[model samples]
Target: MEVGSTRSWDELLPDALGLIFKNLPLQELLTVVPTVCKSWGKAVMGPYCWQEIDIEEWSNRSEPGSVERMLRMLIARSNGSIHKLCVSGLQNEPVFSLIAENARSLRILCLPQSNMSDSIVEKIAGSLSMITFLDLSYCYKISARSLEAIGKNCKLLEGLRRNMHPLIMEERLSQDNEEAHAIATTMPNLKRLETAYLRYINTIGALEIIHSCPQLEYLDLRGCWQVKLDGEYLKDKFPKLKVLGPYVVDRYERNNDYEDWSDFSDSLYDYESSDDENRFGELEFRFYQQFNEDATNGWPPSP
Candidate 1:
């Protein structure tokens, strides 16, 4: 403890090193830090550094099997203590099952643009009872059944992002409101719900969600062309609600309203801006970009 005395970096405790390493990118943690020294390697390989795993960036740049391998390795390192897991490019059921079995403490799960289906989600929802935040945006395979299962099981869920790209005109006309109804019926405790660009959710479904979820403070229905929101009514009913969408119905008649109206324009801005808008905006941009990339690149090739 002399003023001139020095300490080696390797002498630092694993807990302290884990805290420092958590800020580094996943690629660096996997490739660079462990190679520095034996003590650093041990620290990086421990559960402390793997508690909140975010491999989205790494997974996006890697091949399908590579992502799965890395996820399995990291999950093993976490040793049943992963708290927040956000990844993309998930292609199979075994990885999902492994997460449900191992990450008992996981609270936040984001798997945007993955190939997750109803059965897999239904099977895993029971084990993810502790999850508070879930993002399944642009996951085309998920439907109302999965939402219902998640709602019944993850009782503590506070935030959900189920954004999707706008469906074509033919598909939108035949699409049902089952997903919105499922959310309203089961997730009464939800405080934040983002369904941006979901083209099928009509006025009835939107009203059902608003009336059922009394605690909802943030709702993003942007690009939902079917929803015709009475802005005055919504403002009076839920004074605290912050909505982002085209709520005002146009008085002018047009033959192709549905086709042209959903486009984002300065005139469509009706909601009050807040900090949550910025946060949700970032998430929307990230997921939308990822969705486009996945579509163009065709990820998770046939097994």
Candidate 2:
């Protein structure tokens, strides 16, 4: 292979092009890459390339109808082989139903910052039995019943993220006493979990989760102000676990007392100094990477 040699990418086989398409993030593959040429379009538009469909970034940036049409098109192209899907802001139920109807092999599903209901959860659970990872963070409408449905149906589920808006968290501080118990009892296979901004969960619930899910490797209870933990006790209880949030504040912060008590609507501009901002940046980056790691892997689309 000479450095100066001119090779024609147009001459590359369909399988080679499919491999290249497989490596790209779904956004790029759908919008930018396919427009290169007819041959490239033909390769990239194959169902193998549509295995992982992530359009979370398009949330609020485009109209719901437009997103739905795009999704429908991709669903058609996927030919029922979609393994991972992330659509954060598209709140149309018919489109969601279409996704459930088409993407039977879906392993990971993410719908953060979207409207969700018990019926929707039941719909998804009823269709996709192979789901292992699910993210419904910032979905304020979902209740404990929804969680129970997923736990009951998606027996293979290993990772769950269900952080809520801080205002809603405050409202449900007293109401969600039994929710954690539901999780601990039903979802025994859970390995990774993020229940951030949940003021309802108490020490009892947290302990229950730690004790029940022996396979738990990662847990994020950030902004869960009520749940208290003795670090050593947690360390002893779950030897394989790496727990994040207030419990590990001493390890990450200069002043462990300086808590990140934020409302869901506000940005980090309210922070007093750049140091505080920087700390939050690091924390957010770390959490985001972990949150998407499984989906962002070559196999699944990152939500």
Candidate 3:
């Protein structure tokens, strides 16, 4: 007899609804889930739903001002409890400073391709003393100075990734040993490190990290074209550490055509920034629509 009775979505328990929202990415929580109704709107407005703020997917769409405003709103909603943050593409210093000012409890920070500088890294070190994991992959502006800042300040850091900086790869191997030296000199607590595609980094830098980072457990040297390795030396030097090998290709097989190199570089830079000029409104809607289909299938939507 009660089969036809209907309950509104607003009638659902807040805790139950929050569990569903928690599984969603941060962008979806802020832009989509809160828009459903007043009950859900209030539910998602809480700090628990904003603990991890990852904007790498939407980095292409964010402007300096937009990112600042978005962070302000999210930080207020988070109430200073943010622990993990990942952002890419947005390069404004003030916005980054704002993050350091608010998320004091951050533990895992990923800033791949974000155009962050050494000074900014120092500021982060100065602000958050508890950061344990950091990702600086493709952050071309960061150098050994930034590493020094982190090593000196963030004593708890256990994992670090500094893969593929575009500018550094073009320079000579000897010119950029600052990063290796800085790590050896400061971060004695580091356990995991990734240095993929750093073409200039050689055996000396690798050896420095191996000797300096006493707690090293994982090391990724893939695509480090200049690092020559001897199995026996590596085994003897780092008996407890596990290491991934560098990219393998015959050096003599390389193409040295100047015009070809220039063309490749131009194409690479163009593809990297092609999405920067676009907006996120339509993309957000599409992401939301695709979720249900992908969720049921237990797979991500096609890119």
Candidate order, lDDT descending? 1, 2, 3
In the predicted model 2, the residue pairs found to clash are none
Query: Could you tell me the lDDT of residue 289 within candidate 2?
Result: 23
Q: What alpha-carbon RMSD in Å does predicted model 3 have with respect to the real structure? A: 13.3
Best by TM-score: 1
Best-fitting candidate, scored by lDDT = 1
Q: Across residues 165-240, which tens digit of lDDT does each residue of candidate 3 receive?
A: 3234656455766787888888888887767666667789888888888888767665575677775666676666
Residue pairs of candidate 1 with colliding backbone atoms: none
User: 1 or 3: which has the higher TM-score?
Assistant: 1
Which residue ranges in model 2 land beyond 4 Å of their true spot?
A: 1-8, 22-32, 247-281, 285-303
Candidate 3 stretches with Cα past 4 Å from truth are 1-19, 25-28, 61-65, 165-168, 172-174, 249-303
Question: How close is every model to the real structure, measured as TM-score?
Answer: 0.82, 0.76, 0.72
Candidate 1 lDDT for residue 78: 94
lDDT of 2 by residue, 1-303 (tens): 789988688778876887678778767787788799887888787786777777766644676677778888878888898888877666767877887788578887877776668788877777767888888877777777888888898888888887654444556766755768878987999887778666688788888988888787767666676677776766565566766553322212111110111112122222123344445433432222213444322211111
Q: What is the C-alpha lDDT of each candidate?
A: 0.76, 0.67, 0.66
Q: Tens-digit lDDT track for model 1 on 201-268?
A: 88899999989999887777766767887778878888877677632121111111211222333322
Of candidates 2 and 1, the better by TM-score? 1
